[model samples]
Target: MKKAELLRDALIAGNTWCRANPEAITVWVEKVGIETQATGEASFMYSYTIQALATDFPGDVDDLMLPLLGWVWEQQPDLLLNPDSNRKIEFEADIISDDTADFLFRVPVWERVIVTKTGGVVTAEHLSESAMRINSSEWETVFDPASEGNKA
Candidate 1:
């Protein structure tokens, strides 16, 4: 499928998932495009944003989204990590929880596709490292600043 089409589909799926689960207060998708300078190859990346409403629910936002995220990863393992291709792609999902507000914010579910051309043969490799890094950085940014003042 074309990169645009894949992104559109991912967005639609994410929105539907959020709506079906009302605990989700906010949801959106982000697209990241990466291109290689020497190879002139390019790929599109997809991620999801979700925020859960405050309620007495049993599970946290991460708990709910992790499985969904895993499903996406499992369903599209190639898009997650293509080993045979020089092309590289990456994706990540970010989930956040706020005990003070009793709410959760989940953003940036990830997808990436990489394409490379060598000897007229095209290859691709999907990398999850970027996505994981993005999610971790985002999470840290959210909580790290707040935790700074509490240092003993």
Candidate 2:
């Protein structure tokens, strides 16, 4: 399928997922790579990550999700289960920039990263469900809205 079509389907899947999993905190998608075949047709791969809140959740990263949970506690950002609010939970790439980041502190977090192949093949892998405190500065950046006078 074409790139536009692929993107549309991915968005559709994300929306459907959001609908089915209301508790989902964030649905992040990014194009990871691209390859061209003999026909000159290029197929792009995308990566998606989603997180949520639930004690029953299978995996929790104390160092990452815990701080986010605190931000969510008072801010009550928009999530899968609660999207009616104007507030949004930002998904940032710089949250875990370095390897030692998590070793600094533990913050419970649960997230899943999924990859969509060119043909729409979906795959999920657990990147890190561990508590990471090294990215606290970035975390603050991610949740800056909570602290600023303005609320998004």
- Alpha carbon lDDT of residue 89, candidate 1? 32
What is the TM-score of candidate 1? 0.28
- Tens-digit lDDT track for model 2 on 19-83? 35434332333333323335543332232323332221223244344444444432222232234
Candidate 1 lDDT tens digits, 1-152: 23323433443354444335454333343444343445554755444333323233334445444433433343343333445521333323333333322333333334456767799998776654333323333333432334343211
Q: Which candidate should be chosen as best, given lDDT against the real structure? A: 1
Candidate 1 local Cα displacement, residue 52, angstroms: 7.3
Q: For each candidate, what TM-score against the reference?
A: 0.28, 0.19
Candidate 2 backbone clash number: 13
